[model samples]
Target: MARDRSRRSARGNRLGLVIVGVVLLAAGLAALAVGRGLLGGDLAATPLLGDRTNAVLAQQWVPYVAVAVAFVAGFLALRWLMVQGMNDTVGRLYLARDEAGNVEMPESAARGALEQEVADYPGVRRARARLTESGDHPHLRLALTLEDDADVAGIWRRVRSEAITNLRGALELDQVPAVIRMSMTAPARNPRRSLA
Candidate 1:
């Protein structure tokens, strides 16, 4: 699902930033300490990290190694971006296996069934459902329009018991994450008779 991918990508980015930030912070603080004479020695005489000749830094393959690392990092970043910008279609619900072959329920069919079931209840004027499959979980969103005097509590209880419970069972899932919204329709109005 797009939401799942977005969240995962965001978490990865945050973690990477935190690591990079800490490393930079530490390096900067160390440099400041050295510059301010906090290292208990003359700054000019302080031995540098590498040897005088710096043979490792002058290696012939160092440029090639740097190029390889940059290429890998760029490739990974592009992959993450592509995943984030993906289409959310073609998601499905998990169903049981049969003797013939594996059974899978299309998400559109599941959404339609849910909407129909909810709309069939008394006082429900209109209803719609959408299904999105997240990692290891399926999401269900419902929009319901009800009569002005509809029993919100009773209808919601039934919806939870009948629609949500059955959906979870049919999909063989532990839980089906849902977002339900309800609105009341305006009362019907009648035309007034003309005065004589």
Candidate 2:
């Protein structure tokens, strides 16, 4: 589910970028054509800046406003870039609290344990996991690399029934939402078959 949402968000961003690019490209081409008198003689002959426009530009506040707008645009661009690199993984989890003290655990520890458990499965070649959202209501993201002839359905069942159950017990949480992604590698070559 998390992967689906991420994919959808990425698709939307790409679509928006393409639309903006096309609009800008068209506007640029139209401006170039008009400037070169390809669109029409009258439009090309018309001055880009009239006396009224020049008067507005001459105002003392105009430069300040332009600089402010540039700064805002720059800030937004930087923010967007930062968002692109953001991951859903969460940090330290607050486990329990009492008169003694509060227990805290690194998110990596939970993720590592889950990954190791899943990786130990018969057909899984590798496993990666991330704990997202708050510790109180955590979400799991697991990626598994499997052998070519591995039983995907069986592995999924074991992961849900055994691995996730263990994680939930360790976390002492009633429910833990999870999403799993799997990929298969090429089958191993048989030397005897090759010789035959």
Candidate 3:
């Protein structure tokens, strides 16, 4: 859920930036046209700052207000940048809750179990798993290193059918979204065969 929200937020941010960029571009073009006399307006003769605006800037509190606004904007920008590096990896999650109290499980246990299961598979050199979001609806990221001669498609199918299924059953979840990344290592040379 948190991952989805983050993605949506990123999308919205991009959309806002695009909109702002387009508006600024159009305004600049319009200003250029006016300055070139293409649009019947005397841009050079117009005062960049009006008398009323100058009076507001001349106030004693203006500098303080400007500094405060600058600080606030800087803080918000920093926060946004930090958020881009954030991940919603779950630490602990509630497996069950009732009058008997809540049954909690550390997310690392689940991740370890899943990794072990995959690593035990034939031809799989190594496996790693990460659980993200909430316990009720979690997302899994799996990374697998395989032997050069490993059956990639077969292993993929088996993981989707067995490993993920077992994880879902253990977590008592209806569905667990997962992403698997697989890579093959260089083939090992036969010891008995001498290099010519």
Candidate 4:
């Protein structure tokens, strides 16, 4: 998915560069025509204001140079804008690995650890965990499947408290926000069994 987004962003950058290039090329041609009097203008007189002919000729180079510089700057700006948009669109799809060696655990290992820690509580049938980033802090979200006869409010309170406690202890980070979401509640089983 990241690769796909990167490719799309690259394509957008290329398109923007092409547009800037075309604009610069057109501006260059216009500048040449205006400078050389090919656009049906007076050739002998000063093209610009003031009496400094040498300065005016030198200043004539400014428009072409400005167009080239503007083209490059505009292309870079458009590329940056497109890349930022792409990052925002796909940023939440994957978790960033922590740079700190101590916290650089495998994603599966972190999820498994969180799930095991949360599963010991009553009314929890199953649990899945994911680690995300909120600025510099690691954010954990746990989705718990509850038992059939469990009290939802009680389970939620217990799970939420237990999850925060365990995550803080394990990660040793007070900035973490551990969230518990109820994903499913199983249905009660029938006592009668049919033999076929």
Candidate 5:
């Protein structure tokens, strides 16, 4: 959703920049043409400035200023358009937590769903899920908190498989992949405590 919003905003900005550029370019061209006539053409001979000779000289600067401003404005507009194009190539991603408390099914609803699934793992105390896009596939990176003595590899494999299954089911997507990472491990408790 965020990605879609960003793309829309960028597109709007590009359109605005284009409109401003066109207006400025047209105004600049008109100003330059008028300035040229005022400075060097028969209009220059008019004593509007009280001095026909000085009138042309005084107006010569107008065309130069108009042309320079137009060029600068056009360049800026082009640059903005380029930036907007680049933005379209790079969309948005996010880290979210699942809310439904279901880990067996694909939590492909959004970032939140995946996060919730991570938290539901047996050894996990907390979990964070990040959604990313690579090529055409959606990749999920999950960071989980676990007990220190937990079987890290076993838990990681289980989480990865479950997440992939759930996401694939929820999103109806085949390219979903998951990576499980441990963020922290709790200290081991004494097994003999129950006997005491």
Candidate 6:
């Protein structure tokens, strides 16, 4: 019922994406057929594309319009490709509290809060987190960037302790799975003084 609405099932969005993909796929096939001269020759039937007759459709504006449409298609295709590769993460984390009331927080919001808290430590440049669901369970994954001169071992230990305590404690969960990944910033090149 109403409580079920709180969790982000991802079903609706996933179905919507599937529909878009199918439409794009149909459009692509049509474009391919047109390009391959399947519609007879250099001329093609383009309803709403221009005039119905072939000779009238050969104006200079036609090719330019085609090019513009192609550019837009390319952008949409790129965005679709990116979306295909990324993990869908719109799930909400349900938090237990001392009171009997039900509480839920958006996964992105929790990640943002945790990322900011982790960035407070020295040597850590920044942090980003994501929450995703596996079956009925939720997991927190972290990506962190460190300064060139940062202490790896010490910073890692601190990060683990703080992440576990703050995250699990706030969520009121006895256990929360985490995945931590770290990357180091490249060292800055020193500018040499000119020798007079």
Poorest 10 consecutive residues of model 2 by lDDT? 187-196
Models 1 onward score TM values of 0.50, 0.87, 0.68, 0.42, 0.39, 0.52
lDDT of 3 at 120: 94
Candidate 1 residue pairs in clash (backbone atoms < 3 Å): none
lDDT of 4 at 36: 81
Predicted structure with the largest lDDT when compared to the true one: 2
Q: Total clashing residue pairs per candidate?
A: 0, 0, 0, 0, 7, 0
What value of lDDT does candidate 2 attain over all alpha carbons? 0.91
Question: Residues 1-196, candidate 3, lDDT per residue (tens digit)?
Answer: 5657878998999998899899999999987877777866676568778999999999999999999999999999899889878777888867898998988899989899999999999999999898987766788989999998899999999999999999999988888999899999977665477779
Each model's lDDT comes to 0.81, 0.91, 0.89, 0.67, 0.65, 0.76
User: Whole-model lDDT for model 4 versus the true structure?
Assistant: 0.67
TM-score for candidate 3: 0.68
Which candidate, 4 or 6, has the higher TM-score? 6
Estimate, for each residue in 1-196, the C-alpha lDDT of model 4 and write its tens digit. 4346667978987898899899999999988887888876675244456667557657877889889999999998888887566422112222234565333445566567768866877777888887665334566767889887767898777656766676666655665656567865646466677889
lDDT of 1 by residue, 1-196 (tens): 6567768978998898799999999999998888777886787357675584578868999889989999999999899789768654437765766688767777888778888999999989999887765523678778899999999888899898899998898788878877789999987698487899
Identify the superior model by lDDT, candidate 2 or candidate 6: 2
**Cα lDDT of model 2 by residue, 27-135, tens digit:** 9999999999998999999999999999999999999999999999999989988988999888977688689997989998988988988998999999999899786
The TM-score obtained by model 6 is: 0.52
Kindly report the root-mean-square deviation of model 6 from the true structure over all alpha carbons.
Answer: 11.0
Ranking by lDDT: 2, 3, 1, 6, 4, 5
Candidate 4 Cα outliers beyond 4 Å, as residue runs: 1-103, 134-136, 186-196
Model 1 ranges off by over 4 Å? 1-90, 96-101, 189-196
Root mean square deviation (Cα) for candidate 1:
8.4
Q: Which TM-score value belongs to model 4?
A: 0.42
